[model samples]
Target: MLTEARLVAVVVTSAMAGAAPPGVDDDAFLAAMAEDTYELVAGLDSVTPVLVTSMPGMEEIVWPGTPVVEIPDLSGAALVRAAFAALPYGEQAVLLSGDAPDLPALLIGKLFRALGRARLAVCPAADGGAVAIAAHLPFPDWAEVGFDDHDPVGALRASAPAPRTVATGPGWHRLRVPGDIARLDPGLEGWDGTRALLSG
Candidate 1:
């Protein structure tokens, strides 16, 4: 079994590209979403969440106490690859999207637990993509797992062998479109950064 584990959370997000969804100011929304993502990941006591962004000037906005890592202005698998490759090898590294404002902390803990049993752990997004994914270090083929393709999670599932899946509530969704705003829980707690913007 793994011991003295190194857990790194690579929050794969952007403030320039897929940052803006409908019904919100692009820049403001992206910043809020990034903050939400940061709060959610950092809450996991044992995990170190790093803001991996292609957005310039991210340091000025990401929540205090969170680390920021900059990647090339790329998207899809290329972006994922660069972010993952940059992280030093660890026992587990979780890949998440900034759009998942209200991702449950319990689910994130579960991902770490699940990693103990499998080489890969994934939580499927309602839209056939993945809201969060955890992989044993020295992760799998980044090229094979298409990031923004028609079916990102499916491509990832196909590429990784027998990944352990954790059950996450419907709240585990991505805020990518205008309709997605309706899915946000008005009473959401913890992720105050995004909740304040989306709920109001």
Candidate 2:
């Protein structure tokens, strides 16, 4: 999938900040998210992936191979914009949620291949949000991204020129609440870190 594609997966997220999800506190949430980011970086071995964080000194905790991109304390669209801007222009820039750890390596390849056909592609979450986005170069003004709004997936669709859609199932779900973890299967391959954290 990355043969001639300048693909970079920007794991866009922050440390635990808001209310804790059920069955876990802020610390556990942070750990779980770290594991998620770790696996994502490890899984995408072909394309260089980076973890975008607002927290200082997070590089030591994230997966070793992946690099870290720190922004000046931003959130929502601003944070996403900063992360994307830091990376060199690529044929495809995939913005992924660090909290959604269950994405297997196969799915990551599929998303990149889909981008080859469209200027932009998104794997929409079941809740009208987005779990991942693969956009072709010359990124749009992220301020209009409308993150945390009612329908960010819809917003992205409108911003690009006929953006393509990638199919996703339960495995692609994002971890918002503690119960949302149930959507993942610890037994599955490539999610060892998340499995260990959630199981223990």
User: All models: lDDT?
Assistant: 0.64, 0.59
As a TM-score, model 2 comes out at: 0.77
TM-scores of the candidates are 0.80, 0.77
Ten contiguous residues with the weakest lDDT in model 2: 162-171
| Model 1 lDDT-worst window of ten | 162-171
Model 1 deviation from native, Cα RMSD in Å: 3.5
Error of 1 at 168 (Å): 9.6
Q: Which residue pairs of candidate 1 clash?
A: none
Q: After superposition, how far is residue 96 of candidate 1 from its true place, in Å?
A: 1.2
Q: What lDDT score goes with residue 38 in model 2?
A: 58
After superposing candidate 2, which stretches have Cα over 4 Å from the reference?
Answer: 1-5, 10-12, 15-25, 63-65, 161-171
TM-score leader: 1
**lDDT score of residue 106 within candidate 1:** 83
